[model samples]
Target: MELVLRSYCDLRLLLLLLGFSAGAVLSRPTDEGKEVWGYVTVHKDAHMFWWLYYATNPWKNFSELPLIMWLQGGPGGSSTGFGNFEEIGPLDSNLKPRNTTWLQSASLLFVDNPVGTGFSYVNTSDAYTKNLDMVASDMMVLLKTFFDSHTEFQTIPFYIFSESYGGKMAAGISLELHKAIQQGSIKCNFAGVALGDSWISPIDSVLSWGPYLYSMSLLDDQGLAEVSKVAEQVLDAVSEGHYQKATQLWGKAEMVIEQNTDGVNFYNILTKSTPTPAKESSLEFTQSHLVQLCQRHVRHLQQDALSQLMNGPIRKKLKIIPEDHSWGGQATNVFQNMEGDFMKPVISIVDELLEAGVNVTVYNGQLDLIVDTMGQEAWVRKLKWPELSKFNQLKRKALYSDPQSSETSAFVKSYKNLAFFWILRAGHMA
Candidate 1:
């Protein structure tokens, strides 16, 4: 009887060991306290720099965290420089800790994408992205390689967050990423996307610019008519696949509207443009703060870790060889001028994302003229969603709160899986 009892105990212990082994194999590795700073090589000479910040509370498990990939506007802008320092990061201009940073609950990644923005660079000018599709493809490869290297964060809910021209880039990249995930090429969990004052659907966005100015009483009927005429010319150029002409014409028409207005501020329309202190450049201050932040990295990652071993060395090696001629990302912005369908409609893509059960939050400052709340709501009403009429009919709720409490909160409306927030007395920087 004693021998039989001993054998049963051994069998139970064996089963327990097997269960432990299985759990170890299936579970994702935890990256609670880690930071990653590296480059992602997308083309022969294109390298995109990325700096990822882990959630502030490292004690919390990784599964509770949401990872946000932040992209700044501008077809030629730098996400790391502008988005990180000026907009959202750990510190304010005074070098003090930000009271309410997105970093509190989420893991944020600031990438200098498109191969030439910020610290990212291109060894060859020919490899620059020319169109939205090329930019999307390059970003997709970067995401794939980025995830492949850091498998521990694959299970976290990921989001693409952007503003301005970067919003357009995010829209395109989100579609490509959706396809890759469906094809099993990308195994990460994609949660949703958010756009702030996005440059989406040029047809809808640009068409309303003149009318927006007109409604604000900034332009007279005759001036409005002239602006509309220029807009129509822009539409004609875009229709005929002359994107460069459209871009230039659009710029001229926008300038006319700006000149007509009360010194239009892209950031906040209600306020006058303030002069910067002559002694201090914002770039210098941001760079100064970054110097300390980078040095604090526990283990500095190198560029070779991001290279994909597809070609002999083009994609696999980190080549910092400088060309005799370098224009940062000017060539890419120049090439984008001629991109045939770069400014095409993106509402359909957004509609598809909403239908796929992705959460989309679009918040705009009420005072912004570049991508005004009026124009955004107009386009939102036009989207072919299931509850389009209901959403359009849904009354916005006005919330009154102290600026310090909620920071001038305003009207809000939600329908289906999408929501829009109109920030009070805010502008493009909202």
Candidate 2:
């Protein structure tokens, strides 16, 4: 029997907002003149909630700043719940300003993605589909409508960034936006995409984890052998086109590693035997923070009143019986039956983007066991680009971190518009 470690195959590293210079910043809102939060009716009953964050510090031409739209991973997770509340949003748990918030430079838009994730909701259960195309199309509709309403942001340089499965959505969205731009359907700078320890290919990522665990000394000879044996079964399942089964079997090997390691946190083994699974955060605590932000920051925003800002109609349609407890994590089992959803050819997509002169960067935390650096490196190697061979030949140029846990805490190598950072001693946004 497969040990089935909790949420093993799902790895989400909250991505960094690009274009932030090392400039001093204040925590007040920059675009205080604009609407801070709103909902878009992506479908008849599916409403996606979005909160805008200006560069935390004051800037003269804040409207000219690049825009970054962020999504959280779960195939069903909420960017509002995780990315904004738990990870990189402007506020701390008590709704106080977080000194390290990424909004210090780049403006951010965090939406509870797909349909059912976060504050986003659909009227009917059947309205939910986890396929990339449907979600991407809805994203297009939402974005078009957003730009139409807020014409000022339409021409700004826009970026799509995601963690985990959001990265999957970002890929499809990027391609769609490219086409839309050519057709003159959208009027945005449409920069590129950044993925944080995202799940690119189930096959490549799954096959890589066991060997990485072995190298980390978490797997002994017997554990390594068992993992390898299970990996073969996973490979067969994938080749047979059993995507769901392949995902299950792929997770089995890591589950075995966990069993042998006495249930260490797959995210960061050093975190020690925390009974809570390594891949998840405490929903209660995370939600508490989210509620605080909504009440404190959003409630006091300018344009709309508190009731209007909270959006009772959308909330009512969402069928959220409770007040604020409604926001938290979600398991996207809808993906199990979706073909090609487990593994899209993101490698090829990255290549296409690079060829088209789009700046693309994919980075992984070194200590991230959920999406181990080894697995990320393996997949990056498989990227079929003209300069790929040359990229591989170059050593990872030494990198520094003021917060680095080690002397050589990170290293990066880049060619043209593509760069990958291997952060040392970091876990999947833990």
Candidate 3:
């Protein structure tokens, strides 16, 4: 009887092994899959924000792919604005929807972020109140919720990427996430972060405008001499202080190109006389593209932003607000009222991230006068990282519109790790 029992047990063990093998063989492929749509709660103040999240599994053969979280910069912009519109949206080049390629390779996440941005909305009219720290904290909570729901991703490598003002947001959030990990509040296998054409440091970025002007051939030795001779001399003599001088200097710099370029569209080079269209206008989405963008990300942007867009002066008249101000009413001054000091704390945050073994790369388009490449270089020099010698390698590279699109601009300088590249023809949208 004992011998018969041992044989039965061995047979049961073999059957179990076969079942496990079959289960492994029949599992799903990693890449080119459908995105999982979901919402995470933001419990910040008296109000709550239901933030939107688009998540996809990692691509084929790679079961444990890195998870990338993308932030669309603007003190208020939607990740869908660019991430889906241009980079890795669940669509093909023709804008026909498809869950394939890059989306499958990595677990990509794009959040509406902050209470005021994207489809994430708050109940009270007071939901618009925001600041960098508030955003970082809200994101932290959202990430926790994400991990709880997709516990399988708890051990996957994580990365954050952003552009424009999001560079600042990404930096702050990365620092905060590192802190949370250290404190045991959250767990992550955090990787490096990247930003392009980000408006991070004002002093460092402002200088990029000069080179941009020169790139356009708007500033020749003769033109510089001409400006210094009379126009600049007069402005310098009469300026009340540095603030006024800066304003005047920027105006003069703008004027230098205003006469040289087509003069019809001064702000955006891509727009030919008409206002620049969104990248996805070709796809012809049913809902007004703008409305869909706001709905998908920001729950609060009412009809006012649309009205302001229609009215010219109203758009320009919008004021920059403090970093922590509310966005309750019309978003007339949302973008205009920028808190200039937002990037002030980024230096310390970067330092903290590096200390915590996080890799950070800040790149800029040389043609973007708004967030100048020159400024980024100066900022990096100022950081004085002890391992600065590693950043000495520099090589040229080509910047492209998409993985499939033709090359758009040539980039200068490719470094070992911590690096910046100047995209010759791109602007703030780079």
Q: Rank the candidates by TM-score, best first.
A: 2, 1, 3
lDDT of 3 by residue, 23-46 (tens): 233345544444454455567342
Q: What is the C-alpha lDDT of each candidate?
A: 0.62, 0.62, 0.50
lDDT at 125, model 1? 65
CA-only RMSD, every prediction: 15.3, 9.3, 15.3
Candidate 3 global lDDT:
0.50
Task: Report the lDDT of model 2 for residue 104.
Answer: 45
Q: Which number leads on TM-score? A: 2
> What are the per-residue Cα lDDT tens digits for candidate 1 across 71-133?
876555556555654556665434467655656446788887666665577766677777778
Error of 2 at 160 (Å): 1.8
Clashes of each: 0, 1, 20
Location of the lowest summed lDDT over 10 successive residues in candidate 2: 1-10
What's the true lDDT of residue 20 in model 3? 22
Taking all chains together, each candidate's TM-score versus the true structure is 0.74, 0.79, 0.64
Give the clashing residue pairs of candidate 1, or none. Answer: none
lDDT of 3 at 290: 36
Residue 253, candidate 1: C-alpha displacement in angstroms = 0.7
